[model samples]
Target: MRQLFGNRAFVLLMVSDFMQNIGIWIRNMALLFFIMEKSNHDPVAVSLLTVIEYVPIFVISMIGGVLADRWRPKRTMIWGDVLSFLSILLILFVVLAGYWQAVFAVTLVSAVVSQFSQPSSMKIIKRCLPDEHVPAATALSQTLMSLFIILGPMVGTTIYQTFGLLASLISLLVLFAASAIVLTFLPSSVDQAPDTTESAGSLLKDMKAGFSYIASSRLLKVLLVVYVVLALGSGLVQPLDIFVITERLQLDMSSVQWFTALEGLGMLIGGLIAAVIAGKVKGTYLLFAGLSFLGLSTFVEVLSQWPMLTGTMRFLTGVLMAMAQTVLMAVMMQQVDEKFIGRLGGVMMPVFTGMMLIGSGFTGWYMSATSIVVVYFTAGALFLLSSFISMKLPISREPVQEEAEAPVSVNATVKV
Candidate 1:
């Protein structure tokens, strides 16, 4: 653990990610409340904000992924943050012009840039750390995120409520600038761009190659299916989670705030446990176990009216989710060639996002036709199905293709 923390690249990345998390939560909470006030609590406006945030992931992830592969990971990441900063700066001005609705652009710009930036981040992890350190690094990263999940809303809410939208936007600008500065210190590395003579069609050809690469890997295929299926399930209950508090537990709407906090608290504990065990465990098995138990636990939540029981189940659900995602990320890092990380994510994430969007759209109609209990049941069943199917994933830890013999030069990998 000390060795991993002392690695300069890893340390810098984590710091950058921490700042990015702060910026994200600030955007999420501050914008949400601000829009609620300006739009007079119109459900359509709120729903449109959600769509704006997600639609970019569905539309732009692949393009960003492909581009990320052809660009230096460090440089791509820095540019992504810089661009996000500039975009937010622009939004701030438009809002100052009395067009508060321009706040939606903040989410849209960040979402679009993240498609490019996030893939580079995965690639950077593969480049900067040895194969063995990846799991611990992922655990640490997940733990930081869990920390944010637990506290981000409070911080964001506090800032927005106390200082208002202008202050929140300015905070995001500083955060993004800070994140970009942190990325500047990462170990210098090269990407897998084609020769200078390559034509414009090279991007298309690269994307096609990416598709073939995914097709060739049975584990990758199964993983994509697992993610999409799980997304479908989670989407069904995500928007309606408050209903769990109001209907099942017979609690007030206000209780939903504290009620949802359990998952974040659970994730913090779960991330610590996963980090400790990740290196020793078979990730595929962990994935299966997490999902299966999480499914059962979620279903258990539906069966009880007791606050203690339901809250315990939510906490357990968070633990299972964190463990599952931590291991799965480790697996992907170990299995896919570093160069293909961007392309692979590009294809997989958008499909997963698309499935989620599709499922979310269908949910309201399905619930009206049936019942909220039926909807939650459907989510649990889908999770179980994804888990069972994930049993088909290969147990091999070997990469499908060898990565570049060395991407980061020795001198560039300065350890603290």
Candidate 2:
């Protein structure tokens, strides 16, 4: 752990993530409640916020990879944060002018910018760290995410309720600005190869190759299917999450933060546990157990009438999901070609987000027609399907050692 933190580039990236994740949570809760108030807690309006959030990602994921590949990773990340800061600033003003509907734009802009910054982060982790450090890096990243998951809603709600939307927006702006500044301290790009925009056809060609590569690789193909199914499941439940509080628990809408915070708390502890057992566990088993039980947990969560039971299930889901993700990263690191890893992320992200977008789009209407419980029940079923499919994946415990691998060309590394 000491040695891992000793790497300056890694540290800077973590700091940037911390700041940005904090900002995201603040925006998520603050904007969420603000919109709920303006729209009278309409499910469609909230779901629309989700749909808008994913549109840019589904549109940009493949294209962002090409850009991330062409641009310096460090520069790409910094610019992504900067653009996010500026966009949030613009929306903050628009909100102040009484165009409260523009609040959804905040989620949309942040999600779009993240499509770039996120891929760049993966590239940086791949480049700066040695193979041995990957697990530790994964643990540290997930831990940070878990911490924020536990804290973001509470903090975002406190700020939003106490100081109002303006203050929350300002908080977001400052946090993003801080994150951008932190990223600026990251080391210069180690791979400063020239940009790969040779011609319009080159990008299309590379994208074609990326898809072809995934299709040819059975492991990658199975992973994509698992991801797409899980994404759709999660998305179906996400837009209706607040109702678990409003209708189920019979609590105020703002009380939904507690619901999420419990899940985050579970993840926080789960991160620690997963880190401990990561080396001892087979990555594939962890993936299967996590998703399988995660589905069961979600299935159980909506069925319970007690708030404590609901929170417990949420916490369990958090732990399982975090563990699942930690090992899933291991599986990817073990399975995917290193050169192709960046492209793999570029490819997988859009596919997952696209499916999530599909599920999220109709979930609002579905919930209106039925109830929140049915929506989550269906989501759980999808996850179970994903889990069953994941069982077909070939097992391997080795991590990819990039140094020993053969190289692919700049044209192939076309995405950021």
Candidate 3:
């Protein structure tokens, strides 16, 4: 961990990102609760609010990625943070004024505005880290982000329960402001201006090229397909777990909250393990092993009815999921070139987001009509199938040639 933090710029970026994630998670939890309260605890209305928050990402994330590639990443991220902060302030005002409908609209707009930042952040991380350190850095980032998941809900619930909805919104705004401040420290060199030569192409042509690149690469396509499958399978777990705990096991909301926290804790531990073992292990092997564990854990979860066993299985599943995700991301980052990273990210963002959206909707509908146990069994089966599909991909065991390059000082490296 000390070696990983030796790069001051990466450390600063991680700190800012940690704060931003915490704020995002807190706002999300509070928003769900607020919507429930305002609608007289209507489950359908709360679900609608959740849908509104994520729908924009599916609609606009591709454009966000394109803009990230065309503009400077640092500027893009700073502006995104600024817009998000302003949106939060507006939401805060509306909440304070008791205009619940207006708050919902503003929240949806905030979600749209925030989508612009993800590609730029992803590109920056790809550019800044050396090939050898990329896996470890990815693991560190995932660990920090997961750690926030444990705290954010607890803090948000406490604040909402104690103060009010307005306070929760204000807290998010403060965190966004802090994120913007930290982003400002990044050097101008990190931002890559759009290429004049590429400016002549039509939008459709450019988008096609991006898709073509991903399709032509065997490893990239396989990774993407496996991700989609995993996303679809994992989606069933959320609603199924909720039903099992609330309807079958008779656990209250507080217990559910704590169970979620335990899942986050497991992810944190898994990420830390990845970071510690990063350079010593092959990313492909780690990913494969993790996915296998995830499949087995899901099966265990589906069979277990006791609260203790269910919680343990959920925690183990989270750990394996985190390990798989971190390793896959690190491997993909190493495979792609720096110049096209943004465009590649743009192509991936929409696909991944769309898959999750589809998965959520499908799983929600399926669980509504069928038994929770059936849903879990289906999810576990899909996971096992995805693991088998993943094994068919040809992931290279050798490190990329760039991993042998001499380390450059942070001062000398371009920011973008």
Candidate 4:
């Protein structure tokens, strides 16, 4: 871990990711609070906001992928951060101006732009890092992200309570600016571009090509399905957390914030575990174990409605989810060609995002019409189904190669 961070580019990337993640969490908490508190809206409204925020990623992720492949990843990331910063500024302006509806609209636009930025940033990391360190590197990145997740909500809630939403927006904007500055110093490399001669074909053909790539690859197909199910199942728990704390447990808002923080703490631990064990274990086995834990944790929540038990279950769920996600991402990075990483991410984003949207909406509706316990049971069942499906899929392992005679020069740029 120390050696990994010794690479300046990796350190820079980690710092930038950390800043942006902090901003993301703050913005997310603010959006949730704004909808639930200020707007006096229900879960459906929160779901709608989430849908609008994520729908663009589903729609534009492919375009973002193509662009990431065609352009220099670092430059793309810089521009993306710039746009995100601007968007935050716009949100801050609206909040300051007291136009709450306009703030929502601006927030949606900002989310769309951020979605476009994500693929490029991911591509840059893939390009800059060598194959061996990728998993640890990715784990470290996620660890930093989880740390921000731990801090952002607590800090945002405090700021919101003391200084109101406008102050929180301003803090997010400052963080975004810092992220942009950190990203600007990284190395740059363009992703592989599609052949111009093939560009004249039908749009459907291009779409089919992307789908065909996944279809032909057995491992990707299974992984994609697993993630889709995971997204759907996990989505149920997020919105329901608030409901569980307020309605079922009769806890105040501060306890809800603590629950979020505890979940982040669990995720940090999971990421650390992945980092330590990544080189030692087969990615597939780790993934399966993680998924199993996730399903079991969800079931625990369903059976044990006690606040302490439920919170502990949520913490365990975070750990399992982080392990699965970190390992999956690292495995995918290793197995998939660099040129297609962005597109693969693009294809997966919508399926995952859509699942989350549906899950959040379903949980909200279920909570309103039925009981929180019922929602937990349904979520657990879905997770179990996903785990079962994952077990049947063949594991795709990276091909082993002879060790390089010498360390690859850190400054050398490699074309994908």
Candidate 5:
């Protein structure tokens, strides 16, 4: 762990990632409540925020992957931060002008630009860290994310409640500026050779190759299916979170922060746990067990009206999610070739986002027609179903070292 942190390039990249994630969450929390208030808690409008945030990922993730492969990872990441900083400025101006609707538009634009950052960041990590340190790097990254999740909402909600929209926007602006500055220190040397062979037709072929790669691996295909299903279930229930706090629990907007904070705390602990058991435990076991625990926790939350119980359930859900996601990310980092990292992320974006879109859309309409509880119950069932299906995958108890030494490349023949 200390060795990973000692590397200057890795440190700078993590700093940039931390700042960007914090800024994004802070902005999201403020904007979400604002929309809730302006729309008078309308489910469709509130749900649109999730849709707009993900639509770009669905539309441009593939293109972003190709660009990440072709471009310098550091340069791509820095440009993404620059674009995000500019978007924050636009949001500030929109808020100052009292053009509330424009905030959502700006958020959508920012999401589109932000797609380039993740793939590029992953590419950079692959370059900077030795194969042995990849798991540590991933765990540390997840830990940072958990920290932001813990702090962002509490801080954002406080500022929004005490200061105003303008203050929240300014806070985001400062964070983005810091992120851009931090990212500038990242090494400019090329990490991998650019794909000079790419032509007009090459993009489509590259994309098809990514899909084929996934189709050929039973383990990859099953994981993808399970994750997509999980996203669908999540989309159905996530947007209803605000309603659950406010309407179901009879609490105020501020109370939602407690739920978020506890969840983040759980994630932080989960990350630490993943770090300890990284090489020893099979990712397959963690993935399935975590999903099962998370699903059961979600069901518990739906059944409870007590705030303390609900908060505990949310926290447990976070821990399990972090455990599952950390392992999932580590496995991907270990198994995939550096060249296809971006494209794999691109392929994943649409699957996750598309499922989320469906979940959000269905929840929005279904809740309007029925109730939140029904959606919760249905989503829980899906989670259990995903866990059950995962049992059939070819995941083994073998250490990630085995896979790291034998990476599956973009052009590898599909395994029957």
Candidate 6:
């Protein structure tokens, strides 16, 4: 732990990411509330905001991944931050102009840029840290995100409630600018590889190579299948979570807020646990265990009406989710070649996003036709099924280890 924290580059990257995530979540909360108010609590209108945000991920994530592989990670990341900052500025102007609807467009633009930024950031982390530290690093990064999940809404809500939309936008602008500036000082290259000239035609070939590589790896194939299936379940839950808290729990909005806070706390704890046990334990086993826990928690939540029990279930759900994702990320980092991180991100993002979109749309109709509880039950079932199927894969029984020849040069300079 000390070693990981002692790295200057890691700490700086974490700080920048912390600020950016806070700004993004706060903006997300502000927009959700703004839409709810403007649409007079229409579920469809509110859900439409989520749809718009994810649509770009479905449309452009694969292309962005390809770009990430071709471009230097630092440069790609810096440009992404700049674009996000500009989008926030545009949203601020739209808010000032009383064009509430324009926020949707701004959100879409930010999400599109994120496809590039997210993969680039991953590439940097993969290159900067040693293979052994990847799990702890992944944990720490996720733990910070859990912290934001806890605080972002509270902070965003407080600011929005007090100072209004302009203040929120201004906060995002500052955060993005800070992130971009910090990113600029990072090393241009951590490892020197022979440069090769490639024509535009090579890009298509590269894309094909990425797909073929994933298809060829039995481990990656199983992981990808499980990932897409889980995304489908999460898609159903995310859009309808508020409804479960308000309608089923028979609680007010404050209850929903508290549930989120508790869940974040659980995730923080889970991340720490995952970090501690990472290299010692089989990540594939952890992944399946987390999925099973998620299913059990969801099932329990539906069976109980007591607020305390439901909240506890939610917290447990968060713990399971954090553990599962942390292990999954560690496994991916260890298994995939560092050179293909960008391409892997590209392939994975579209699969997750596209399935999620389909699930969310179907869930909306399913809820209208059946019941919210049924949807919850469905999610729980999918999670359990994912766990069972994952058990059959050989990767689940094998522990992850650093490759005999590490890809990233540990001695490579990371300026600032």
Model 4 off-target regions past 4 Å?
A: 29-49, 92-100, 160-170, 189-206, 236-256, 305-308, 363-375, 396-416
Model 1: residues >4 Å from true position, as ranges? 190-201, 402-416
Q: Give the Å shift of residue 123 in candidate 6.
A: 0.7
Candidate 5: TM-score?
A: 0.81
lDDT of 5 by residue, 1-416 (tens): 78887988899987888778778877888889999998899999888998888788879899888667666787777788888889989988887788888977999989988888899898888788776677777877888889876776677788889998778888888888888788787766534446555333456666776666666666777778887988999899988999888877889988887788888899999888777676677667787888887778778877788998999888887877888888778767766667677877998778887898789878989998888788888899888888777676675433222132233334322210
Residue pairs of candidate 1 with colliding backbone atoms:
none
lDDT of each candidate versus the true structure: 0.82, 0.77, 0.74, 0.73, 0.78, 0.78
lDDT tens per residue, model 4, 176-259: 888878877775443343444433333344444455566667778888889888899879887776767777677786788777
Stretches off by above 4 angstroms in model 5 are: 29-50, 92-104, 160-171, 188-190, 195-201, 239-257, 302-311, 363-377, 391-416
Write down the worst ten-residue block by lDDT for model 3. 406-415
Model 2 score (lDDT): 0.77
lDDT of 6: 0.78
TM-score per candidate, in order?
0.91, 0.80, 0.87, 0.81, 0.81, 0.85
Model 3 regions more than 4 Å off:
96-98, 195-200, 246-254, 357-372, 396-416
Model 3, residue 318: C-alpha shift (Å)? 2.4
Give lDDT tens digits, candidate 3, residues 249-292: 67785578767887898999999988888879766667777777
Which pairs clash (backbone N, Cα, C closer than 3 Å) in model 2?
A: 65-415, 65-416, 66-414, 66-415, 68-416, 69-415, 69-416
Better of 1 and 6 by TM-score: 1
Off by over 4 Å in 2: 30-48, 92-110, 189-191, 194-201, 235-259, 302-310, 357-382, 395-416
TM-score of 2: 0.80
Q: What is the lDDT of candidate 4?
A: 0.73
Candidate 6 TM-score versus the reference: 0.85
For residues 116-232, what per-residue lDDT tens digits would candidate 6 score against the true structure?
A: 888777878878888788889998877888888888778999988998877888888999999989887776564223245333335566676677667667778888888888889
lDDT of 1 at 104: 79
Q: Summing lDDT over every window of 10 consecutive residues in candidate 5, give the lowest-scoring window.
A: 407-416
